[model samples]
Target: MSALPWMQHLIVVPVLLPLLVGALLIPVAQNRHGFKFAASAVSGVLLWLLSLALLGMADGGHWPDGIGVYLASNWAAPFGIALMVDRLSALMLVLTSTIALAALVFGARRWDRVGVHFHSLFQFLLMGLNGAFLTNDLFNLFVFFEVMLAASYGLVLHGYNLRRIQAGMQYVAVNLVASLLFLIGVSLIYGATGTLNIADLTLRVAALGPQDTYLLRIGASVLALAFLTKGAMWPLGFWLPTTYAAASPPVAAMLVLMTKVGVYALLRVWLAVFGDAAGELEGFGLAALSVGGMATLLFGAVGMLASQDGGRMAGYGAIISSGTLLAVLGHSGSAVLASGLYYLIGSTLAMAAFMLLIELTERIRPPGAALLAITMEAFAIEDKPEDPVGVGIPGTLAFLGLSFVACALVISGMPPLSGFVAKFSLFHALLAMPGRVPPATWLLIALMLLAGLAAIIALMRLGVRTFWASGAVTPPRLQISEVLPVGGLVALCVALTLQAGAVFDYLSRTVDGLARSGSYTERVLGEPPVMRPAGGEVAR
Candidate 1:
């Protein structure tokens, strides 16, 4: 049978179906708990299937070009706000759906109590996420972001605790300002270029003279800052740790998908729109990317070292990972892109698992004590399998040991794991580039190495105190439900490491398209001769 054109519906359905499902589950949830779980599970399974279908379609070489949209009522772009999907969009869709499914399944028990509409907000959030990834127009992107962020407000505040409320407020405030900036930036671009269609704007920007180029660059930079805030770049990331820390396990797990949205926007809109055309502008475009990225990485690592809370530390680690991703993007080579993509997959998986694990561990700590301080206060509590409070997960000591060792190997750029491979590819890209590996580059490498060592030592010390300390009492019993999600996530990490070659190959192809402007435009706007940066021909 021939594939139906309605296949495009698969993309929209992942977002829309969940919203509808959530609404359906609301009345039944209060009466039948099993129904709620079933709804979430069915939704998850359907989304996963859809994601797999998307992957197959992308790999089939049949994907369309130039801002694809299957409108709610068959409307077109710039008129009805199209939902576009390129390879980048497809990749993000798969990742977000997978994470959402995993998080939902892992938190099935919790959702049973938190109310059925939890799934509703979750689906609505995913709608926003998928929309953000697929939208081609700037105003639509902002609208999607608000949709997602507003839902996140509910999700983050779900537990109804004072801390959750405070954190949620801070999150709302910071992101609100960032959103305003995003709108302002988009308006400026519209004013300057007289167009908001990304493809058309890209072409017009390319045709501008040097003065107009500066205006475009300024607008682009402002736009990038808004995205940076969303992505948790340093100085703008203060709210992330608190919000993630205070949120419930499922909420925290789902939030991991949000950061990638910023990275994707930067890659899809910022870099794609600028192309080689803006790279040649005198005031450090790609060069600034490297510097900003490295700075963010260092800030994250330093914050991690200073952090005394497990959830907060995980948040910082995520920031570090984001920064590393941005730096990898800056290099703009096949190796670097491959490494960045690999790291993105692995780090996101691990971070989600770790966040859930922190939540579980939190249950075992003293009422006010954080998970990061569990070891320091271990002696106060006795291990009680019956009680839910002050009892850490059984064998968590062992898990913590394993986590420390794995972390050391991964972050230190050691052999055999995904992080090592990614860093190796990135370094190779640096070496292959024309000039020196920039003093800033060297500083980042040094900081990363140091941070890796610090993480190893800190995690080991914490593990030792919690696991083998002479006076410490054992904490509470392990939650079997909790174990499955984190373990599953860790298992994925191992699987990704094993499949590093295949992952790198896919990324290499994607990176090739990104590094060459001609390939990008041809895929998006059809084949055309183009003026490129550094006085070179990007032939189709």
Candidate 2:
């Protein structure tokens, strides 16, 4: 179209600005902590402002037809990489930036002290994240994904301990394979459709006959597998707990955005490309997706029930939430979009708080002999450091307990919080679906309820151990620095509950954007009725 708007410039700036600052932060990583922090702040502020600008534009119904494409060397789509932000991408942008900023501020405390290049790696990771979320081309998406993973390699191994090294190795290995699958999938799709632009592929993949359906399905499966690895869905997610546990808290919190990218890609590409394929089959993929989603939900709950460690437990909970979202996606009913969006918000918020709580607990517990004496009095041979039994709370532990309660209720889907609101919307969506209710759907509901109960029990056990148990040891007092982060998150959760109506409406609008992929394709591709192929010709 005409010259690119100033706002589109803001989008690319978030991606490139961080990379420049991250590189700059590296050489000064050791000596000038203040400089690193300032660099981080500048990058973080720009990202936040960019996100807010996108949101404002979206609110004003900012659709200017003819694609908002930013091309390097002035090459167009299908030949050159491009960054494109639709309404949904912009929403994710804001959410990712907000969470990253919070986590960076929380994480910098230790990284700044330890001579680590935390600021640099953090910015690099953000660069990867922002680029991945905003890019319109598949190859460009892969590039951004790898860029993010590389930064993760450094962040996960930041401490250089045996645990960090081992965990990072596993994390890198799993994702490397995932990246390969991603590239292979891209190649297959390209070979089949002769285009890598996602919007173009959506128009082409359906034209190939049923004979080629197998290849398309295989391609879709490969891409889904790569994302599943990212989403931490069951059987593919073993690396998440170990790697996240080993990393610093901010790093773990920051990494949460990555899985959502996987989920986002799954939602975006499948709906944009393959959903059109399944349109003729009455949404056949929904059944398979629901089955996998239920399995993941149950798998994660089982892991949570069997584990006592706080960090690992939080990781399992995250997996469970991911499954819940996937399951929502599998429901082909009208409300599925709303349900998926609500659950997405709830799960992200709960997981964020849970990660922070785990870090807080580890920091507050007493070390060594005193810790042992307390455990001995409580009748345990060794201190299960993850569950600190017999500790009395008067200062920091009290506030931590308060946080734990918020985390437990929100995560367990208790009422009056965002989690409950989200789940309620999903359940309502489920029941509203037409035709006979499938056994699998009912099973999912039951499993979700069961998972909620199990998470509640685990969280209760943890709370009693760390906050309420009567024994020999006292918890270290919390500094404002520590409390502020946890307190701020808790406050945010409370606000989420208070503004449930407004948030739910926001979620509804977002889901509307998701469910109607035609509108999205139309907006990006400058065509109305972005339809699938049908009757031996590409459907329009």
Candidate 3:
């Protein structure tokens, strides 16, 4: 394998593999379920393995500054499409592939059969996600963003019920507007800097005059709005809960990482292009980001309390996680950012597992029971029914119940879990800051505590209603395929908890390396540009 020709092209494989597989699967007949599942599963496993290898290479410093730059068609950076794999991007790729594999396995049981070309769409989505993470330029980022959004539109409506269609419509509308803003912002930035490559932009931004700097700031603000919308920031995020809730469980679980894409863009752009080197623009939007992040946290907390549906609750949990990360990034400290990265990974895993668990647990209730409860509450009616007491609960039920509790603890940032470790690290980072803590930082701390409290209350209520209330319990027929994914994610969270020191060390180094924009620029654009005649085409 090491001697293989394609092994040298590892960076592009993450995107190319999925794109080819998905495109090929489009022509396969739907009746070939065996072929579809086998193809998709094998692709998923290979993707996961590839991401692991990339992660190891990046973390082990096999590449210079833990950065691997791949030029398409042998064209130099800032001229042709380039893919960059660093510790941060590699980590994201690993997470994306891990979740993709789990979601595919879980959906293979039945959800994949509900729609034509499900596997194809899923693979395309993976391609888009991986490309978005790896692309070195904002233009390609927008392209990959649209690809991901398009695949998500299909997946969101995959199980095509009326409710899903309605939710998908809203989702589509919001993202379309976001995509437009993303394009406009990119155009503005390119106009200002004469380049779309992030590394080049970082160098160009430092040399801009006051007028161009103002324009660049405006462009960055517009881009930030686009990203904030996708990140589920308040006022722009009203569609998220309904959209996420409407999607099938496996799809919803996969969708958990989508918001992080926005967060990743923010971190990359902020640290690379707008860091301390951009004299006038240094920390230009941090204030707004912090304020918006706090608002998002507040919104998520209120929404969590108001939510009666498990899916909606999980969606709010995602919002909370996004908000926390946004606020921490605004702090502009490497330690805090490292802790935020840890929190980001832990929260995403816990939320994905919880989203998967919601569908399984909800199946245990009698049909229409939730609707009946709502109707009863609205009509001010109370009904208590006698229940048989001596029978023991099923093993599946107990497993799900315990899983739910673990998820709850993780989401709420309780003790003895990765979530708690992440929050604790954040707290320590905040306290360890060199200067006196600002009022805004204090407010962020307060909100973080409150958000956890809200999660605890909401999840406790949900647990009581679902697992403790008196009712006829209908045990859900659990499949090993479904159960394994949920368990695997939870186990990963536990692993993260146990390996916190090592993980934090890696993340800290990643953050430190990100602060050195010159190294990145040198590594990406140091090679000579490829010159071609006007009539000839270059192959990528």
Give each model a TM-score. Answer: 0.85, 0.89, 0.94
Q: lDDT per prediction?
A: 0.69, 0.74, 0.88
Over the stretch 464-490, how does candidate 2's per-residue lDDT look in tens digits? 556544344467655565666667777
- lDDT, candidate 1, 376-427, per-residue tens: 4555665433444875555765564465455445544466666677677666
Weakest 10 consecutive residues of candidate 1 by summed lDDT? 522-531
Cα lDDT of candidate 2 equals 0.74
Whose lDDT is higher: candidate 2's or candidate 3's?
3
Candidate 1 regions exceeding 4 Å error are 1-4, 26-31, 64-80, 209-212, 278-284, 331-335, 363-415, 470-476, 515-540
Tens digit of lDDT per residue, candidate 3, span 169-266? 99999999999999999999988889999989888887998888888988998999899999998888889999889999889988899989999998
For model 3, give the RMSD to the true fold.
Answer: 3.3
Output the better candidate (1/2) by TM-score: 2
lDDT of prediction 1: 0.69
Those runs of model 2 whose alpha carbons end farther than 4 Å from true positions after fitting are 64-72, 276-284, 368-395, 470-475, 527-540
Q: Which candidate is the best by TM-score?
A: 3
Worst 10 residues of 3 by lDDT: 1-10
How big is the positional error of residue 61 in model 2, measured in Å on the Cα after superposition?
A: 1.3
